[model samples]
Target: MQVVKQLNPLIFLAPLAMLSLPLGAPNSITQSLALLLLAPIAFIATKSAIKKPIFITILIGTLLVSLFQVALNPNKEYSVYQAIRSALPFYLLCAIVVSYKKILARIIAFEDRTPGSVQKLFDRAVRVFATLSFIQTTTFFLGFSLANALSQSENDRVMIFQTTSIVLVFFYSIIRRNFINIFLTSIVIIGTGSKAIFVATLLLTFFAAYSRPKFSMLLKIVGGTLILGGTLFYFNPLVIERLAEFAINSDGEKFKDATREYEIEQAKETLLENPATTVLGAGFAMQVSHGVPSLDPAWEENSKYDIENGYWGALVKLGFFFTMLFALSIAKGLPRDEFLMAILLVQSVMFMKTSYQLFAYMDGVCMLLWSICMVAINKINANRNSHQSQFQQSIQR
Candidate 1:
């Protein structure tokens, strides 16, 4: 398909989609708005993709999986109509993002466009969100926020994945490495107190360090971080408390205080109960009846403990075949650029923590990652290839 003469409307939605407000702002509103807004973009992108067999073909494989999901029934407890009605939105979200990726890939990879403000703008939007959330968390830790604020702030920490993911990408994508964003997201991660993010951070730092003038600098960086971390630990009692929870207790159990102990067990039972459901999940996006009692009864329909864990969420929802298909699509389609590669690496680590990519919740953040990935892949690879061609011509000359 020919590149559109006009800019993709995603530029306007990109920031809106990524904007998850900080300081206990109503995220349900934002999440709804994000999905609501993307509905048309999904339609538009799909319509555009239809004209081009190549772009549509890329998503046809996965869209079919989402389609077949509408029919597959491993657990008779849920209705067939339930899959079509309930999974409609979920399917739409996945389609929109996948379609956008292919379109953006065409623009970036083959169309010879350079990484432009469209991307930096999305990064900047998330960067601001991450920084505000970081400040929000810091203030909460310092005892400035209301008693009710921490849950959302902690949820904001979940979003640090997006912030941190963006931070890692800019190291190789944007002009003049985004050190400020990197610094902000890193501190937010400390508040995360998540071993997954911590592990990913260490590996990211290792790779970043490896690229430094001397490999020996890794020692100095780690040592300095440890010392600073110790200093921060003393002052940040809340951080100390968060980290302490991860430590083994007198009972010799680790993560005793961890939430989702129930969700973990539920997901395991659901997946292991039947080989049919195990290989093919109970069904796509089946709303759990007892999702969250504290919220509206209607909201409970969205509840499924299975979703809390990314691996199980994807596995229990799409089962093995489609889950791997979705993963391989992301893996195969992404360009060989460090910026995108770093995000994928961190996301790989995040599979243990959340279902951002797998289940398609918090998908605006997922869109940001995918959008950035396509932009980077398209622009970086295209530019690199062009330069290589020019270099070959020069050699021949």
Candidate 2:
């Protein structure tokens, strides 16, 4: 452990390199190894490590919630072991990789000695985040395009478009304060043809425009709305036809509406029927006869969807206690920045439509999002206090 700790910081980015490598690696194993490898770097970077109360509370609450579910699960097979199967992997990975103790203090201390030095630290942070976001978005697009050129698997194409769209939206939101980055991301997101990403991006644009009380902001909002709205209106068949059809006829739409409504209704019914299980959940995989269900089982995998999406899924699987803990953790720790808020909203919505509970799936993105918000908030508060103190001293003098 000590030897690993003593190694170079460059080693920390080794996993990131695999991300850019030709798609030869087993993506899951590579991501897991990368995070495990980077944990030490995170530990070293974490200085003055204090187990914050909120973090501790969240941890405890989640555990209690899981236990509660175990107790309430009416299914004879439901047990604590199954709960572990569902929630432990992602939560553990997040806990290990994500912390601010080492990185923020070092960067802020080094960046500025003056009253407003925190601003420099923030700018530096933004640059680092923006660069990584660009790289990830670009790599996903490259992979998608390559796959599309070689074969026409609808699954591959959809995955490519979805990945590109979500990352582009998040990246754009992160740098909403930067016009050039935002503009570039906007173009890429449009190219991706994902309704979720498009809607999320537009929400972000509207938020950025309204965050400041200036005519320029209003004009950008109006101009951006025109271009984005018009482009989708014109060229994107998916947007103009499918999305519009779904939007107007959500209750009667064929694919999306049917799927969404079926899942939602089933989940609600399940909760209602098993009131006792509502707190902790029916104990993961209650829908299945055993741990593994056959691919072409009579009861489709869609039964899982009936329980809820990500957040609700967490509640059902981990119990209400843990879900609330996770929610409180976010509320307490994340900053009030417009960009941060937008990303959080987007993530929350995404999780509703799809499962993002896999360890490798959520760890990197969630960690980065949490770190950015916490660090930015710390800088903002520190600067605000310093300014107030200086003003008071001047008055005294």
Predicted structure with the largest TM-score when compared to the true one: 1
TM-score of each model, paired residue for residue: 0.68, 0.65
Model 1, position 214: C-alpha lDDT score: 60
Could you give candidate 2's per-residue lDDT for residues 1-397 as a string of tens digits? 8544323322333343233333433434434454465565545533322266655554565566445554555654443433444444545433432344344444444334344544544444444444443454345445643311111223222232124223433444443456655554454454455566566666666665666557876786678678767875664445456557767674674545555555555555555556555654444535422222335452244344223355555555545655565566556544455545665656565665544433214343433433443454457566778999999999999
**lDDT score, candidate 1:** 0.52
TM-score of 2: 0.65
Candidate 1, RMSD to the unseen true structure:
5.9
lDDT of 1 at 41: 54
Alpha-carbon deviation at 242 in model 1, angstroms: 3.9
**Candidate 1: tens digits of C-alpha lDDT, residues 160-183:** 324444335334322234556555
Candidate 2 residue 164 C-alpha distance from true site, Å: 8.8
Q: Could you list the CA RMSD of all candidates, in the order they appear?
A: 5.9, 6.4
